[model samples]
Target chain A: MRPVADVLIVLALALVAASSTAAVLARDPVRQSTVLALLGLSLALLFAVLQAPDVALSQLAVGSALTPLMLLLSVRKVRRKGKEGGSHRNAGNRTGSTDQEGRR
Target chain B: MNGWLSAAALLLLVGFAPTVWGAASGPVRRRVMAQNLATLAGCLVLLLLAQGYARPSYVDLALVLAVLGPAGTLVYARLLADELAERPARDPVARALGRAMTPLAAVCVPLVVLPLCVATGPGRAMVKLLAIGALLIGGNIVSTRALSARHATGHTPRGTGHTPQATGPERHTTGGQSGAAGG
Candidate 1:
């Protein structure tokens, strides 16, 4: 029974590691936003386990909600800019058709 | 090392880990569902943590998570409707989210809170726990419905069902503006 709590901390840490890596490695902006949200979740869990509830609270707010909001908003703005540029050139070009699609 | 801590750990491993993987690698809808699951699991884990560590104050963490988690997922669903509505991606994730919010919430909240209530002996703390559990389950249900609504309507305008050709960037721009307002 004693070892199990330690295992929890270890697993939370593992989750943090795996999710952070995945957040960076993710491709699509929308999907990456999901990974970012996951990263925030695990990180908040880690903070809670370490006995820092205050820090964990802030982390929960910023990590889970705000970060995803900011990331998705920025991505949306950039995508909109791209679409406006495309429609400028030719009305036929919709989303995912911009030449910059190969960037990331 | 206690029963609550052990339970929390086990729940995290079994329930939360898969969500991480699901959110990390999948289609947009799948990731959204996984993120929703992660929030539910995280809230439950925090409740266990509160009991495990013997700190009534810690339950506040779970309470806050319960409120904010679904809010975040709802925001994701609204903003990313275009991507999700691009095509249905066979969302087992959403069904899993329904499970997280419904049956899991039904099972875990009462199970933990009841015992915690007994332990706290019908005080203000017990009241707080009950309230948190209610809020968690209620918020989860609302968020689940909102997330799945786009899938139901196929993200098209209500009256425009007859015209497949009407889905141009202009329509999406209007949709995006409304979504931004909602966000």
Candidate 2:
């Protein structure tokens, strides 16, 4: 019983480590949020293996759902802002350069 | 050491590892699909763990996961509508996964939950387990339907004609409609 439990704990720990690393290394913010959710799931499993049901429950709520949702929302906001800003800057640059040429 | 623990461990290796890999590096569609799969796998693992540890109370964890997992996937499907529209998940692997999602849920729920119910016998606990299983299968079906529906709608307008001007608003309208339906 002890040996099997130890094996389960180790497997879960490995999953946690791999997922956390993947989350950090992910290039796209959207992909990162996805990986982060998986990371949360793995961590909750690890906590469960460690006999910490209370922690696992909270982790399940926050890590799996809340954190990823937050991350994805923020990413969406930033991308929208960036798109608007880029178009605005391009317009400003074009107009400003033409105005300077006319004055010159 | 126990059969339950061994089962959990086996599932961890077989069921979850690929999902982690799939979620980590893939197209957004695949990643989202993988994340959904991870949640399902995670919920099952919790159930097995509860049995392994001889703590029925721990089933609550699975219950919470069962409820929350599909909600998260729906959130992704809703929020990432534009992205999903821009690039349809037409890749063979994504299509295969999307096709498999429902059948997998249908099969796995029974495979895992029946044994659990047998172990638990006829009681409130057994009922709770059955409820979780139902929720899991139902959630999986809804989410997969949402995903495939979104994919179909996202692709149709563009496929019919390549006019960017024509498809842009059309795509948005379709995406909006699907989002409403999914929500």
Q: What's the CA error at residue B4 for candidate 2, in Å?
A: 1.1
Models 1 onward score TM values of 0.81, 0.85
**lDDT score, residue B147, model 1?**
62
CAPRI class assigned to model 2: acceptable
TM-score of predicted structure 2, chain A: 0.80
Q: Worst lDDT window (10 residues) for model 1 chain A?
A: A89-98
True contacts kept of each: 0.80, 0.78
Clashing pairs in 1: none
Model 2 lDDT at residue A88: 61
Instruction: Provide chain B's TM-score, model 2.
Output: 0.85
lDDT of 2 by residue, B94-145 (tens): 7788889878988987899999999889999999999999888878777777
Candidate whose TM-score is highest: 2
Runs of candidate 1 exceeding 4 Å displacement: A87-104, B93-101, B155-183
